[model samples]
Target chain A: MLVVNTEFVPGFEVTKVLGLVQGNTIRAKHVGRDIAAGLKNLVGGELKGYTELLTEARRQAIERMISQAEQLGADAVVNVRFTTSAVTAGAAELYAYGTAVTLAGGA
Target chain B: MDGDAATFNFLILLVPIVLIVLGAGVGGLTARTHLRSLERREAELTSIEVNNLKFVRDPGSAADTRMVLGQVVIATDYFKSLATALRNLVGGEMRAAEGLMNRARREALVRMLEDARSMNADEVWNVRFGFSNISQMRGKQGAMQVEVFAWGTAVRRGASA
Candidate 1:
């Protein structure tokens, strides 16, 4: 499925609006990784553990979003956006939302 | 007793001077190096056109659309930490920390542009950034940090629309 953050797709035209579809996930690393991150803080650099955690969460959220779009028979999802919240000290919530639409000519 | 007191006073005077010199030296060097690298990389990406405009004027045949993302996380240096400590007392703006955030945003954008350029995309639009911190300030879970993430769509414009 075609997915973009723009209001409209360049190649395809939107035929039918399927309203808003959303997906979200919350995730956290284990205590071992948190301990490693605490050590990494001393040197000052990228916290790889947290990065991976967020990336994975985003991926899962997007997958679920896409599945929802598919159920709505959307050919593309436009104006996609991602948001994140620190639900707690360790866990984070990532949400993906977009407008699902059917292409005019059908891709 | 006199000699020991004098020695103690001398050591007390030397410590902060040493810290200031260290902070300035390291902070200056890091800023210089980062600026040089940012300039070099920016020059290399001069050809890749990036904009936040939603529409492109010369959109070619609708080629393809794909998501591109760039992210960077920066931690405070000794100088910034020291400055922050001072700022906390006076409660004014923290220039040191602000500079790091600026650098992170620019660096993240550059990386995102590079990614789009590598994908053979002529332009990217509707760019957005996400800023967050990890497990910082969770009572020893981690040190403080700032993360900048840039995301956008790389579109291959149609040759003739």
Candidate 2:
């Protein structure tokens, strides 16, 4: 399925609005990564471990959102948006949402 | 016992002072270096058009379009965290924290542009950013960190609509 953050795809017209589909996941950093992060904080730089964790979490969230769209018979997802929240000190929640729609000619 | 207590107190004061000094020296260098690198890369990638507009005015025969994402997590050094803590009491703008967040955002966007470049895309549209604080807390010691996620649709110009 096609996914774009814009309201409409460049060359295609949206035929049906399948309402809103969303997915979210909460992930916690492991102890090993946290210790490494604490040390990295001293000098200040990119936390590769945390970055990868977030990327993985975001991918999972998007995957779930896409699966939901597929279930709705959507050819594409439009106007996609992502949000994140710190559920606690060590865990964060990533949420992806979009309007699922069917294109005129379909995907 | 009295002499030992005095030395213990002296050591306690010296530890944080040393930490702040290290943080200032190293962390400052890291931020400056990253900023300079970002500037250089941004200048180099000036050819790629990037914008938040939902639609491109002239796609010029869109060849292909796909979603691209870039993310980064940056942590603040002890010095900045100390500055923030002090600024909290004054109830003023925390410039140190602001700089940290700015660096993270720029880094994420730059990475996204690089991703588009790799795909041989000319422009990126509908760009959006997401941010979060992923600092782990440990009692009174919590490292300050910010995560920036940038995403957009990369369009490759071709002979097709």
Per-prediction DockQ: 0.35, 0.56
TM-score of chain B of each: 0.77, 0.90
Docking class of 1: acceptable
> How well is each residue in A1-107 modelled by candidate 2, as lDDT tens digits?
88878888766778899999999999988889989988888888899998998899999999999999999999888888999987776778899999999987412
* List of clashing residue pairs for candidate 2: none
TM-score of each: 0.80, 0.91
Q: Candidate 2: lDDT over CA atoms?
A: 0.86
Q: Per-residue lDDT tens digits of candidate 2, residues B77-99?
A: 98888888888889988899889
**Model 1 per-residue lDDT tens digits across residues A12-102:** 6678999999999988757887777654444344567666666677888989999999999998888888887777776677888999999
| TM-score of the first chain alone, every candidate | 0.94, 0.96
- State which candidate has the highest lDDT: 2
How far is B118's C-alpha from truth in model 2 (Å)?
2.3
* Candidate 1 backbone collisions, by pair: B60-B157, B60-B158, B60-B159, B61-B158, B61-B159, B62-B158
Model 1 alpha-carbon drift over 4 Å, by segment: B1-34, B56-60, B135-143, B159-161
Report the lDDT of model 1 for residue A78. Answer: 85
